[model samples]
Target: MSASAQGYVAAELARGGYQNVHDLLSQACATHPQRTAFSCGDDHLTYAELGSRADAFARYLRYHAGLQPGDRLALQLPNCLQYPIAVFGALKAGLVIVNTNPQYTAAEARHQFHDSGAKAILVLDRLLPLVRAVQADTELQQIILTSVDDLQQPIYESQEDGTLRFMQALRLGEQRSPVQREAGLDRLALLQYTGGTTGVSKGAMLTHRNLLANVLQTIELFDQPGLLEPEKDVRIAPLPLYHIMAFATNCLSSVGMGLHTVFIRDGRNLDETIGAMQRHPFSLLSGINTLFVGLMNHPEFRRIDFSHLKWATSGGAPLNSEVGRRWQALTGAPIREGFGLTEASPVVATGTQLSPYREGYIGQALIETELRTVDDEGNDVPPETPGELWLRGPQVMQGYWQRPDETAKVLTPDGWLKTGDIALLDADGFVKIVDRKKDMILVSGFNVFPNEIEDVLMQHPSVRECVAVGVPDARKGEAVKVFVSLKDDTVDERALLEHCRQYLTGYKMPSFLELRDELPKTAVGKLLRRQLRDEASAAAS
Candidate 1:
């Protein structure tokens, strides 16, 4: 039997109409052309202003850059004014936008750029070194590098066609590749990376239709029809745009509803994001579990006025029940936790403003999405039983890009994308994640795969046998814990962890280490991850 709550009935969500996300933007532009569309610091972009900028960007890409349709452009940026302009412009130009996290090092950047086969890249000045490091190995034919002050030039002078040859040597000084562009909703629009069972990241092929479908559904779920007066709601967008939830709730939903979004340039600048909320008193706040949890801890969070907040949505990791309780107690607005992946246009299920916020459950599926749990053999599991959650909907991605064999393994023949997430649906129809097929850790909104870490760990001669597991952490949500069986008695656990920091990201390194004689294993010699996890919990308690 699954460990799900009982008597939860779900209502269908509407993902209807509009071929792709482009129409949503176009519709909002037509409906609220003059309303403010986005804000960064003192700068405000009206719907007409944003749409026109996107239009100029589209024309600029086509005529100046000469990027053809379906040509992928690696977008390496953090949340700012350029992000939306570049994203929507790429969509308008009919090019696939492959989003990369700005924090990624050159190695990570190179891998993604190589895998995506991007012809061009748009990088922020601060991150130019990373792009410069990987440029030689990548397939990129051209680069469109911009600075922080790129959009500050009156929006008239700065947003124009300015050409500069980036490199002097290697015969690339005087020449720039012309642009090729695409137009339509059916075309591939975005390729967002999600971790695979194998621990390597795979690009999920999200069509314009897929993104637009999820965006429409999200609007239906969160839009306060009567409460949110047209163009009156201000939404706080602090999360990274590369994540689907942030993209949908912040960028896409804001466009469709014509809500003005305050772009949070840096998480390090949480004060700015929080102050914007207090000064403007945002009507809607959407982010991951970590963002909200961190905000709640901020001394400013206690001083803010909750009366203006109409909706709060959290996804990425499960909302810690304690965090949810504290939020409700503090702000009065319930946290509407949702479920999504890079594969399902990022939103499979969501709790609406109308639904009572539950402690752990990620509310009902959006309209048109059919979620079911099945055993290993693909047989349907009875209701309330934890099983592998599979999603079938218009929002589901086509497949993994250029990974047919791997895609076939996860994407079922009848269109069910095996989420690999262990989930349970109650009799009333609410879904809650319980486990994952891979030894993957959800550190805030990012996926930290153990295999990636284990490979790094094996490189150290001191690491005899190490198995990593997700240990519960209240702040970041989950901390990585590795149980080690040493080959040499002289190896110190602390030294091994420090060694891991060299190759693995901070979130992926083992925060807790346990020296063991020999790890518990199955008869087939597979390390029993469950046993290690149980040990971690027992020791913590």
Candidate 2:
């Protein structure tokens, strides 16, 4: 508590041992040697096994692929066990891992691959088509396709579509590449892409220290109740691993704390997740609002046991009040909603999982994180007033890759990373996000950036001018709402909708449509979305 004690601790921290995620994992693997570190359906991996596989993959990447240090490898997959395997493997091989969401389109995928200068790609078979379309144009040289049952022996065929219809589908991956280097803790572990909710997606250059700091920060956040103790804590891994929340909370947290990370294979099966929850008596379950809502909606939700649930953190999107209340009522537990972006190592603030419910608020800063609410000019805003949330802490990312101009705009000279969402902090320091600076929609937990939507809408010949806005939705928090004005008055709503569907994901497509004689624009002729939102709200009222 005293200044002398603080200085002493800081001096000790500077002594440096394991400087990265790989170093952190190495210690964990050694400490918990035979403990189960990761599990999916019937497949379980012990800490020693996980570390061994990663090292083997690392050797494979170097000896066979000839990928030297500082190179990037693009990985696009869902929440399968291989997600961690590949991520750890890449880190072991001294390569930067570029994470991609399987749901991304060819255009979205290309932006990340080209921007990051990735040389190799690891993909799931079902997503192969999406990557194949863009590989010819990108810098990637090798493609390694993984099956859903790669971890478990005698892999079953779940489906030809790559869903792993049965656990027996996995065959030995014929070794194609060899990995040759040891990953130093100081090197980059992940080149995570920004959601681009505001504009073009930029890769946040996160080093081993950046990610490792956040992992320790998270451990402190939950250390209050000792909820993270291994052998006692079991975590649900249903959230997409590509997202930082799952990568950090579900996978990295498990390794850092020596807990079991259970993968929710085939999220379509509600019984599987629920069954795992009961069988394992999971102590902690971290996820987004949509997942909790979906879980409660399932017919078997009532039957699953929540007797052992100790930590339930909600992030990646706002946790709806209705879902929160219902979950508390059913399970007698609070869904602690937190807030973070792809930057900041994806954790700026979080609510207390063991405390009472604080509806509509993303809780206090984790230990050692200092936050500020500032206006466009960077001056501090009064408490309870909305403004962009800026943070200067151990968890904030280093910078954007290769885009000095872009990074300069977001990172303040004093080290604060400007989060584009408008937020308000109560006198108690709890943050509540009121609005977003970017024209982005939060459909469930997915980001639907308006610029991307407008780009798709503009393809229609009849679309003269258009604007994409987020409309409130009861179930999804917000849905893509589009406003359009036709050039020749020859297009119908159906045709325009069809054009958008062909290019974007189902969640990104507009849920509400409006036709206008001419869109509301500023005096200079730039379309004004706030004005359109005002009109839409007025009509709704």
Cα TM-score of candidate 2:
0.90
Per-residue lDDT of model 1, residues 65-184, tens digit only: 677788898887778787777777778778889988877756678889999999888777567667777878888876776665556642222232332321111113113332233445
Give the least accurate 10-residue stretch of model 2, judged by summed lDDT: 165-174
For each candidate, give its TM-score against the true structure: 0.89, 0.90
Candidate 2 per-residue lDDT, tens place, 1-541, comes to 0011123213323543645567656877878888888888888888887776776667656766677878998888767777776677778678899988887878888888889999988887777777778877789886776767766543444433322221221122124344434645557778998756555788998877678777777766566555456867788877778877777778776788888888887554667777877678777787777678778888888887888887588888888888888888999877888887778887878877554456788778766677889988889999999889888776678788988988888887889888888999777778889988877778867777888889889988888889988876666677778999998867788889988988886778898888989888889988899988767656644
Q: Once superposed on the true structure, which residue ranges of model 2 sit more than 4 Å away at CA?
A: 1-16, 153-185, 266-272, 354-357, 535-541
Query: Model 1: runs farther than 4 Å from truth?
Result: 1-20, 153-182, 222-224, 486-495, 515-518, 522-524
Query: Which one wins on TM-score?
Result: 2
Q: lDDT per model, in order? A: 0.76, 0.75
